[model samples]
Target: MTARERLRDYHAKRDFGRTGEPRGRGAAVGDEPRFVVQIHDASTLHFDFRLQVGDVLKSWSVPKGPSGDPRDKRLAVPTEDHPLEYEEYEGVIPAGEYGGGTVIVWDHGTFEPLSHDRKGRPVDFAESLDHGHATFRLHGEKLRGEYALTRFRTGKDESWLLVKGSADHARRQGTPDPRRARSVHSGRTLAQVAGNS
Candidate 1:
């Protein structure tokens, strides 16, 4: 399906007139696919992990945020697809909105799809994701090296795991305190963003 079709649910959940969130005018794809991790201080504070798939961003709600440590297995719950423009979003979502809260662009950068078939042939990143697993290397300002997202459940209880690969790029450090994390775009924390709004 096209990006427009994939974003229907996202659009339905949001009222463009009231929210500052983008209406998702399809953007031109760049040479490399992008990934972003946004800290969302919603009713339940969490991280939103998004990967560019086709023209939209396939997203997930990561409760504990992403970690640099290889041993950290972060639970990731799938969410509606988002617009490419959302990568730059950093502000407060109004109260009573679908996701009313403060938001900050925690990290974002290009990524290299590393999924391969049993024969070692490069597989399409979207296809790999559809099959419940995908591996990629992130080149973000704060997050680098290899990572993987693997779906562990499906249907109503669907969930996935985001784990840092145990490669040379893996770090001994894990995720920082979400309240203390600053936006890569604005250098503001959730409290600061909310305070300004």
Candidate 2:
């Protein structure tokens, strides 16, 4: 589907005049697919993980955020498709609006699709995701290394697992405390961002 069609749900849930979030003009796709992890201090704090697929960013609300440790299986709940411009979004979403909260760009960078088929043939990244699993190597300011998102459940309680790959970049250290983690874009914590807004 085109970006406009994919973003219908996103647009329906948000009011552009009330919120500062991007309305998702057709931004140019980059050479490599991009990924962003944004910390949102909404009703319940969570990390917003987004991966560029075609013209839109397929998003997931990762409760504990992505980790560098392969042992940690982070729960990722699928959300709406976001605009490409959301990668640089960092500020407070006005009160009473959809997803009203403070947001900060925790990590943003390009990713190399690493999904492969049963016979070891490389599969299209979007196709891989449609099949409920996709692997990729993230080259971000803070998060570097390989990661995979695998769907564990479907239907009413759909969810996916975000886990780091057991590679050279894997470390014992997991995700940091959400409250203490600072934005890689502005080097500001959630509290600071909320305070400024």
TM-score of each: 0.98, 0.97
lDDT of 1 by residue, 14-111 (tens): 98888899888977789999999999999999999999998999999999988999889999999999999998888888999999999999999999
Model 2 misplacement above 4 A: none
lDDT of 2 by residue, 40-90 (tens): 999899999999999999999998898888999999999999999999999
Worst 10 residues of 2 by lDDT: 167-176
What CA RMSD would candidate 2 show? 0.9
- Residue 127 in model 1: shift from native, Å? 0.3
